[model samples]
Target: MASNPYEVEHGIKPSAPRQTRRPDMSSFHSALHELLPEPSSSSSNRNVGPTPDALRSLFTLVLDQMTALRNQAPAGVDTELLQGLIEELVVDREHPDMKGFLTQDDLDALDRVPKKQLKQGELCPICTEAFLDDPYPLVVVLPCSDERIDPATGLTIHVKHEKHRFDLECVGPWLLSKGSCPMCRQDVNAEKKRKEIGNQERKKANAVDDEDEQDIVDGLYG
Candidate 1:
């Protein structure tokens, strides 16, 4: 109510229009961010794992190492040569009449293994059965140092021969596991290595002898 009638006659405008009391939206704006946070560099928002860039770097390093190893790795010709010789030995042993395969194994000893069937009393220790009464029964040969009668000298001679034979099935497992003769326990691998060393030594000696022989022939011609 207009208390003073005299003031109203002058029109004082009610004390600067009664300043309005606005609501405090500063706290409301702050609370909006707290409740619904913006998507940014917050730790909780990121996935926990190795980054893609890091994985790419690791893979690149592996590829480089593999490439380096491939460049430096040897061709393994010696291993391959040895394997080929072993296979050749098998082939030559099967077909002695066939020509053109180098072998250290004695073909005479191979053929010397009695083709006669095993006696009924001679039971295989592994299978505990006599040789099968079939047309073909497999017999395996292994390296051994055994004595044999010298035909010319009439004296006993110790020789490296494949005299021992066993059932194919029994010998196969035994060779793989032990690389040895089943009866004598003589290592075939050892024998093979020894033969290889001997062959190399012989080759070296022969090469030296050939050089000497050529020198003598040259001197004679000169």
Candidate 2:
């Protein structure tokens, strides 16, 4: 008797092909079927449609990347032009653009903010006034409501509130004195003052040297 392949090694024939039946498509499905054109040089002349969401997605991605980069960046860099603009706003009172903004109410408020005097006690370095206002001076209240008068100067350093803190007394006179901090001596006009003082010292030193030389000449002659 011939040995059966199925009974041989592994119990299966390696060359056997599995048979499958194809599903029959109904007439309705056959009528609905449509053929897509294969690419050819002639067919390639037709315009290709872009994916609908592609441009929008690309724009959104770019915007997101820009936002992330902006979040990662440090504070802004300074520019001389911007500095000049700020200086014009604060110091150049005569700048023509500034005239229209100063109305009577604004001027009154500016004037009413009160001159800060260096009192013996209770002076806020910020407002230069005694903190008579319960919480603090109106200006000191700005940047926070907790602004209080300095115990020594009677002015608002903390524990009060106001809109402006440019101590007119300190700033005004200091600006008059070549734009420097009156109390701390931070020179805004640094170059000008340095040059002035240097020249003055140089002149004094030269005078002293001249006096010493004349004294030596007189001693030699004697």
Candidate 3:
């Protein structure tokens, strides 16, 4: 939301909420609770602690959501950033290094998960339909996987098996965000810089080529 790491790592806040939609889990409620369980709700001063299983579940939940978001991403959104974020999350959860806790790059990398494809007659994550009763229907296969985290390490070390495809039209708009995927909690900005760098490189290359061609033409004509 701060658009980059300088803002995120420095604890810079966004001017306004990014989502005008319901269910913003990016804040303390989901972010903190997912990592650590809330204190005892029943007792005003009682302290409840987070369990290892809760940590596992939270990471697992994030992973599953990411996988779903990635698999269901539309044509417009690419899985590059989300996929990268997943890898980082895996590292953080596994390593448990508070000394270097989440850096800006790490924060920038973290974003939404992909969507899961529909099953035979299973409703789409979006449309809530197969759009028909077609089993083994012709579709785009958005590849996805299941992850397993090490309880001792507090991280996801590996993924297993691939999940199936999805409908493009159904999942596009969410994936079209500038930095992150939909279903993300606290996304980082990505595409803009890469795009700018690409454009600059292309311009330089084209400029050199144009100069060479112009020289050649001048020599030939002269």
lDDT of 3 by residue, 117-153 (tens): 4344553433334523433333333222334554554
Residue lDDT tens for model 1, 122-159: 53333333444323555555556665665654544446
Better of 1 and 2 by TM-score: 1
Candidate 2, run of 10 with poorest lDDT = 98-107
C-alpha TM-scores of all predictions: 0.34, 0.17, 0.26
Task: Write down the worst ten-residue block by lDDT for model 3.
Answer: 172-181
Best model per TM-score: 1
Q: Whole-model Cα lDDT per candidate?
A: 0.40, 0.32, 0.40
TM-score of 1: 0.34
User: Mind giving the per-residue lDDT tens digits that candidate 2 earns over 1-80?
Assistant: 46677768667645543321111123212221221122223425322322324323322332332233234333652233
Global lDDT of model 1: 0.40
Cα deviation in Å at residue 112, candidate 2? 15
lDDT of 1 at 104: 19
Clashes of each: 0, 27, 15
Ranking of all candidate structures by their lDDT, best first: 1, 3, 2
Query: Model 3, residue 172: displacement in angstroms?
Result: 21
